[model samples]
Target: MSAFHVKVKWGKEMYPDIELDTGEPPMVFKAQLFALTGVQPHRQKIMLRGATIKDETWDGIKMKDGVTILMMGSKEEDVPVEPTEKTSFIEDMTEAERNTMLQLPVGIKNLGNTCYLNAVIQCLKTVPELHSAIKEYKPKQPESSSLLTLAVDSASLLTLAIQDCYKTMNSGKTAVPLILVNLFRTTFPKFAEQGEQGKFLQQDASECWTELMRLLMQEITAKDPEKTAQNFRTSLIDQFFSGEFSCEWKCVESEEEEVTKSTDNFQQLLCHISQDVKYLHTGLVARIQEQITKKSAILDRDAVYTKKSKISRLPAYLTVEMVRFFYKEKEAVNAKILKDVKFPIVLDIFELCTEELQKRLLPNREKYKDMEEREIEEERALKRGKPGDVIKKPKTRSMPFSFEDDLGSNNSGFYQLQAVLTHQGRSSSSGHYVSWIRLKGKEWLKCDDDEVTSVTEEEILKLSGGGDWHCAYILLYGPRILEVVEEGEETEVETKIGEET
Candidate 1:
């Protein structure tokens, strides 16, 4: 039924070599083999030629025209024992295999000997507990990313050691590529099953490579070979976020404010707020990391930890909070100390988190769903309107609409904010500002910039449609922040902050 390569000796061990037959081409190797053979293998394992193999049946093929070959008894005791508990060098293995196989070169995150991972890697072989720690960090899911960390900070040192005894076809002058190639070869097949990420991988690989190269290039050219890579990383980050990604600011306690405070209540508030915010941020990051661990499409290139010591100044060029205090009597409410992820990346970690959340939340949106048929026509009209092209006013906006609070959980203290019908063609302007907000809580809760200045009707009208308007700013604060004060002519509770982009 099928072809076979047989080394037959009566009463001797059955040594085997396999060759495909039944006229099966490599691509059709599996399916054709099944059709030819009346007997099929019990289990399937992938072979190098994209063929699936099962337990071989000598009966399925002719071993020298049905000559009965006797085999020696199974050598159960001679079976190889798998090593556990530790890695050991055996004389049987070659040198290159030991270095290239055991020592992962590329994409291994070399945490500055400054971090805890270094200690873990150093003691992994020696200590069982340390080995377990390493195991814990490995990705449990196929879709998730494994943490790219090194046991030592100086992978280059490790590289040099390997270089002295063994040579690898190392290029790019960095050990990263070698490491990445091994990783890619190992993991790419697992992911290629779904076939969704091929395009993204192709696109991201070049950009990421260029980014790394550009960073290294600067340091080499400046005669500061030492600082080149690190500086390049920093510069890449700066460039990416220059004008991309709309970010909204949330206030955290400033360091100067933290150190100056002698009050116990003040300290407690900071600790509590910090704890809450930290919990939220940590949960978000964990979800992202978990995804990276599971998906191969996502590279856990790096986990960015914001430097906690420094203060955060909002991006330059966008002057949002020029006039600090909003809401007249409200005390300090600002994000003084800034801590956030440093790296700008589109990792699978983020993607998996997004997918799971969307499933649970039912937030799937088809592309361009928000565009109306009329809106599409309008866009077409606009595109055609070049120089000397007459523009047409949009169709009538006389449709009626109303707003209702999503009272799903009233206890959430969150309101269901929506838009309502405004008066017909009223010349008066109404505005909703979302660019930024000043914390408008009591002396205990507010972060520095709390007082809001009152503006006239004309000033408000001009920028009501400034593109960033959202529902309304919601506040949950103690009653102390609700004091009424008569200022100027009007006694309005001015809680808005100066506009920021």
Candidate 2:
């Protein structure tokens, strides 16, 4: 059968309307009960119709609507009790203790002017699929010695180094990406440039991000070969992080020339900042349609052309780079723009897509709106309930925005900001970069080299450029998930059905 609601009994408490999906293992259901009853999943002993439920399957037991499940377990406290009753401050705790209490991820240490690399790595780690692919990556030995084969080996070694770095960070210690940095510098010699003081020069984080993604795209393939063949995207980077743009170029000098159409793949979108551009959306719109000089067949010589482009495909993860730096001829440096450009927490790019894509996005957009409204109504009902009343949470199901055949494409043009990399100086070469990552709800983690701290949504919004303060340079946005729920008016069900013996 499909998913259905059931009642769970634990000691003197009764949780009604606990939805269980038969497709998933019983352990998942038990985990859900664990959330409500505070009992560990392994310790939860569930019984239905006098038959003990196994962790793997629900074989002989038949389930229906409103069935009763008896669960027996006790919540274990993991933290040790303090001897003294005095208040405890975070400053008094050790590094491990502080990280545990704040739920912050480990930071990366800088090896002299390596903040750009650290910031880019931290931002990219937000994509769990990338990490999974790296773990499973195994490069083949080169059969014959060639430049191409050596390049492949280098890329593979870099991927392995990144995997090791991630493993070290997961151990709750500061990760020093020395091997990864060496591999990166060897692959891209420009990053190895040194100043007069024999110190490595600082690099642009956006450029570093682009180069790293390019390497990953070359080395990391999809986990399932059959699925990859059917989808035509061989690499996980292409499947999850690449987008397609459709463009039309028309000659402005010769009206009789036919408009040329083309499509191109891009891993990131550039937002050009100008005096008229006060918001990110405006900058992106202005960047997409511009005038260029090209050779026209009708006019033999170089002629002005109007290039208009629109997004034909969107990926699960979208990267946007702010064009805040420009090369100065006199200073021989990339000067930074300190103009403030406002961005949104939730961005909707429906207007920036092709007509066909916009039509495909409507269904999921409407479903998302309906689910949000239902959640609001449920919250209002909970507030109206009597004091000390326990309300059953509404059941939610994962809804994919893309087509069934497309594994990692986004059908809905809605995105939520996941990570932001900001620069804190006037020049790209001299500025320091930091990564701000969203941990959950309103909580965020700020990683500045080896220092990691917790911040809020309010602080993240202030990162928009204005002056010498930290200005958002690169933004990583993930698809906004839509959890579809059943259509029914929630009523106040009694919390206690019957007292347990």
Candidate 3:
């Protein structure tokens, strides 16, 4: 008899490489599971080979090594309630004990309406690459740069200050980086200026995002250019957060056209408005949909030019800024658009791509469509099945072609939303900025200054701006990579069964 290793998953927990003897009876396996998961042997259902394992020899079922098994049973145990003779009230607890029980996360103090900066800090923490880069960062050629010079140079101070804060966050201690705050004030003097009672005036979240991204690009080091091209992979921000556009300008009078290419090297996608703003994807598609009239190119004659734009490159991460704030000359302030523009958890941009790019993305799109159909079929069968019946799962295959350098590129022009920066108020200069960050599955976190709390997917969907509540101002979308199970990795059991992790 030989022993085999397999993983057993119960809920979110997984136990990998659990050894089992093939010579042992099914009851013996249940006993082992009972010890590991605290599930009664009789109540536990060991599923393998498309049927529940019974009290038969392991050889009778022909279990294989390196296979996964699903063990389903209630982990909760009921405890009988008893009458309490004595109870402690809140007033009875010691001060130290109460402090331990009510521990709070370290938060940045708002230096007079600095919520914009605070919100930005909390959101950027979600980027793992940024965290790692800041941790490994070193101030190169310090002798070449003086503190006075660094203070004047926004890039230098911003880099040092950001790295300092990141280091503090990494230390697992809750502390604020006052140095960073001062550096930010120095960089943007307008923000440092007092508005009311020594408080700073509200700043735009989009501006904060832009400035931070610019500083990060200047401070963060990129990998060797030659190696990146050779491997078809680039740095995280450049690989995913950047986009390229090809532009053509034609003069109406001369009937002459000039073609030029421009790149959004700074990781920001501008949202173009249409007649009625309903969905985010629609507005984005409209941005590159057609040609628009521009200022006259000729000085002597009244001649106009038509400018056409098209996307040439798609990054791993997409940043879309809703053009909600426009300068009002009469009001002398940026006006806000309260229009409710619905967005999606999963956004497809195939309609916004160039013809050749769309052709390249079709293969992955088809694969995803087929997978969706298979999943639906499985779900339908599951709905019709009786209780305790094992429902089979559909297997997924990989796409044929994808970018070599970037694993998370939108092979099929599909994106999953990762973060949203929202504003709640009438004007950009007066609204309260908050950061909503995705926290695994349908759960999200709302970071409003020092306060952080869990939120639902429904709440996130409602952020599409209608009233005074927080409206989505900036949206960050990440590529949804297609999952391809290897041939031998997933095979139907001769008798038809399932695998779980």
Q: Give the TM-score of candidate 1.
A: 0.15
10 residues in a row with least lDDT, candidate 1: 261-270
lDDT of 2 by residue, 1-501 (tens): 767777778889776656777765575565455434546455678999889999768899798988988998888645687688677699998775588566579899898899999999899889878877776666654564332212234576677767767766776778877667766886788998999989999998988998999889888886554543253387889888888899999998988999999988888889999899999999888977899998877789999999999998888889999999999999999999999999899888888899988998887788788777876876675667766565555566678755565777887899989999999998999979999999886679999987888899999999999988999999999988887764574643344212110
Residue runs of model 1 more than 4 Å from their true location after superposition: 1-91, 94-274, 277-501
Q: How displaced is residue 28 in candidate 1, in Å? A: 58
All-Cα superposition RMSD per candidate: 29.5, 18.5, 21.6
**How many backbone clashes does every candidate have?**
30, 0, 4
Query: Which should have the higher TM-score, number 1 or number 3?
Result: 3
Better of 2 and 3 by lDDT: 2
Best by lDDT: 2
Clashing residue pairs, candidate 2?
none
Stretch of 10 with least lDDT, candidate 3: 492-501
TM-scores of the candidates are: 0.15, 0.75, 0.67
Query: Order of candidates by TM-score, top first?
Result: 2, 3, 1
Candidate 2 error regions (>4 Å) = 1-91, 95-97, 100-103, 141-152, 223-232, 375-392, 486-501
User: In candidate 3, what are the lDDT values of residues 1-501, reduced to their tens digit?
Assistant: 466777777778677766676654455455456445556454678777676777555544667777888888885544668967577566885543343344422344465577888777867776655667766765444364222112124455456666655554454334354556655765666666676576677888788888887677666765444433232235445644676666666665564445444443337777755557688877876666354555555445555665556665666677889888878999898888888899999888777666877887786777677566765776676567655566655355555223555443456788778789899887889878888888776778776765556789999999998788888988888776565545666654221223221
Q: What global local distance difference test value does model 1 have?
A: 0.22
